[model samples]
Target: MDPISLILGAILVGAAKGSGDVASGAVVDAYNGFREALRRRLAGRKPAQTAVEEYTADPDNWRPALETYLQQADAQKDEELLASASAVLSAADPDGASHGKYAVQIYGAQGVQVGDRNIQTNNYRSGP
Candidate 1:
């Protein structure tokens, strides 16, 4: 959905991968690159750095603070950081579509769209 949510999800995924005992070198490298990029972006901002560290520990609890800082830093617009985060997510979840954890049910919907970067131009015209 939103950029902050995307970044937070990437962070959580990277953290999970790093915590695993059998993580691949590529995954680890990608996670490290993402973290480093974030760290660099939040270099002089103590609160932002703290938010990141705290959010890693308790994501749900620290989400707002972390989100605020991330927005303040314009992290979504940071190409390097976004690329690094994408790398971590790609390395951790190569499927790029589903990780065997989704159950979506849409009912009575028109022009329904799922996932990101989507463009759905719907035109309903009266005809016979």
Candidate 2:
């Protein structure tokens, strides 16, 4: 997945968990912070604000709107927003269901490893 989708997925998962009793303490706090960050980023836009409201009310059905809102807000480029969303996801799903239980999405990546205990060393040098 692209960064945009990755972050959006995290936000959605966090939202789902946060709305339920499963979320408490740190999870709730992180989820709230993520929502607040999104709200601040989308302020002064009635449609965006409406999308957020709708998403909060019905996360399952309002995802497309929130996704659009995120795109309009340029969420992918906002490291702070990304971090906030990631925090919520981490707090809500500590086992990293963020990438799916056993799935990972990697694109244009190098020397990436998963599902194993391994060591890697990189000696990258670029020249003509």
What value does the lDDT take at residue 97 in candidate 1?
Answer: 24
- lDDT for model 2 comes to 0.69
Q: What digit string (tens of lDDT, one per residue) describes model 2 on residues 1-128?
A: 34555556556666677767666788788878887877778888888778766765686678678778778788778877777776776777678645563345687887664433435687778898
lDDT of 1: 0.77
Best by TM-score: 1
Model 1, 1-128: lDDT tens per residue? Answer: 34566578678878888657798888899998899999898889999998887888898789889989999999979989887876777778778626621123456777775544445689998899
- The alpha-carbon lDDT assigned to residue 4 of candidate 2 equals 56
Mark the regions of model 2 whose C-alpha exceeds 4 Å error after superposition. 19-22, 56-61, 97-128
Q: How high is each candidate's TM-score?
A: 0.72, 0.63
Clashes of each: 0, 0
